[model samples]
Target: MNLGTIGIWSLAFTHGDRGEAREAAAELEDLGYGTLWLGGSPGGNPSGDLATAADVLDATDRVTVATGCVSIWEQPAARLAAAYHALPAHQRARLLVGLGVSHAECIDRYRRPYAALVGYLDELDAASPPLPASARIVGAHGPRMTRLGAARTLGVHPYLVDVGHTVRARSDLDTTSLLATEQTVILSTDPEAARHQARTMLAPYLGLANYREAWLRIGFEPHDLAHGGSDRLIDALFAHGTPEEIAARITKHTAAGADHIALQVVTAHRTLFARTAWRELAAALC
Candidate 1:
């Protein structure tokens, strides 16, 4: 469950294309990163999503691959269970399935979202091809879901979050459970320019209620959430500065009790994997 450091969280598929999700995975592995995390897809067949992870597992030898999460509403438990069973036993350990009960608006056609996830886990447990409980993680934010994650999966993968929520989530789970947080990084020395970039990049999450509430809990004011984000909000969530400063931000998440901190470089540069942002941060942290 120790999904390793400096993974890519590209929303590239949204704006354009991922080429092959596995191609990015292969490059990330070659970059010396320890994991490849993919998400931002609201709904999709679980098997196909799991197959994406499988492609990465097949392409690389060391790095673990995870869904930053796949919506429980979109995919069935049996589907994920089958995918988990299809992989070689050794490969299975390297594939972590992160599940989530997504936003209500996004899950409109699904029945009883929370209950549905509980049922899905139950069905997964009951399935002929069940995954080891340790191979799956949950995308939980609030207390109830956090508790569910603690009980049902390996740990929690909370997105658009900070160390404060990481602290709270760690407290909610058993000490052994994993808490891998996603931290956004933009390597810019200018404070105004750094935050401007951070704000523009964070515009979408600012609209999600789950993220809005989580930011509020971390002391971000309602006004701070407006438009893009206030400078203060941007500064706290996005790690922007020198590479050393970015490493310091990632370290803060570890200090706050995160088992792993997924570093995302916020840039329009498609060649980010080959660029300085990833290399500099990787050298600094790992």
Candidate 2:
């Protein structure tokens, strides 16, 4: 997992046009982002599929393309393992599979999530050739899963996190494990405008218990999670303002113990190829 200091995680990559996504991915690699995280919503991809990851990997030569996470309950280990082997050797080399036990509210079969994740790992281990632990990542936030990620796979990919949680997660794992944290940002100078984009992007997540618990554990109060998140909550989770200001916030994660920061830029208009924002951020970030 040679993911450098910065990567781009895009929700639109999974939601928009594939051809455009491939082209954007190639450009991002040229821009110097180490990884391209396919940001799918919870219980999405319906079958725990890796097709989107495959598309990004096929388009780029060097940058690692990750799932951000595909749910265990949604896709079987054998099917996922098979999909991994289906890619060409070159593409496979640059692919990173991120797995998670998504929120119970979104998954009907969600039960004993931790235990289920353990079992899923077991199944993957039993697969033909197997999806190598070195090529996979765990979507973890809590202590137990964070430790599991350190011990089992490449490392943890924590989403919707603050500097406080990154520090604690690093403490839970040994220094060798990759602490790839996803950061949401809005490249806007106006406070009101930024919050609106942040809130719109945050509303669906607020209802998910997995992220809710992670936020609370990091010292966010119940009030912070209310009504599309409080100003304090929005401010804490999102990095807004100019490109330089946002870059500074992304750096906070690195200082707090993050090995890699997967940057997700949120804007009022949703599009897969967010070239302008990526280009601007790369000037300050990469």
Candidate 3:
């Protein structure tokens, strides 16, 4: 699928009001976003379930719909494959399945995640109607899994990452393949207000080994991870400020080698309707 240079990632599509989710997808498509990503969990929660793809695909005419990740442990290969095949041909063509071995903390069956993921992929290929390698991507953050994603799937979708990681990840892959990255943004000029929202959204991930390890690999020290994350850590992982400032931050990812940027606007309000922020970013970036 032609995932335009930009996409919108949201938990709203996964857990928000169904009717509003459909409307939002259509509006995002009209706003010129090339893809709509079903973001798993902002924090260390389980999210972006595989089933959410059908809802977005059915609601939008052309915007490509992708799961930020569908945990291999959550949905069996055969069942996910059946769901994929059930979609109308056109819709299926626009879908990208992001498969991941979610954090062990959240999964009761999480064990030897890498080996299990490989087995899951084997099963996907073995299903009656295979889930093609070209139509999927991996949620990879390390060298080993990154290499696997490059060889077997579309590419890696690294969430909660920074420009430096993008540079290294690009170096890890060949010229071909996708390097789609998800960026968390808080649209506020006030550092205090923005960081507050960011910290709230970041709290759950701080305790998750997967994300903590990823951050440490990318230059964050132990001190940076403590006390709800230092200013530097929050600043590095999240793009906060005005729309233009956020756009500039996102551009750094592109310059570092990201093929597509998935923009997710997180707010202090518990509500998932972030359309206002979405529109502002669309104006500045898209």
Among the numbered candidates, top lDDT falls to 2
Who wins the TM-score comparison?
Answer: 2
Going through the candidates in the order shown, the clash numbers are: 0, 0, 1
lDDT by residue for model 3 (1-286), tens: 7899999988777778878988999999999999998877533213333456887788889888998788887778898888888878998899999888888788876799789988999998999999889889999998888888998899999999889999989988878989999999998999998899899999988998989999999888999999999999999999999999988987899999999999888965443869998898899988
lDDT order, best first, reads: 2, 3, 1
Task: Show where candidate 3 strays beyond 4 Å.
Answer: 42-50, 269-271
lDDT value, candidate 3, whole model: 0.86
As for candidate 2, its clashing pairs are none
Per-candidate Cα RMSD to the true structure, in Å, reads 2.6, 1.3, 1.8
Note the Cα lDDT for every prediction shown. Answer: 0.74, 0.88, 0.86
Name model 2 segments beyond 4 Å from true.
269-271
Give the lowest summed-lDDT range of ten residues in model 1. Answer: 10-19
In the range 129-188, model 1's lDDT, one tens digit per residue, is 677678888888887888888888888888777777888888898988888888888888
Which scores better on TM-score, 1 or 2? 2
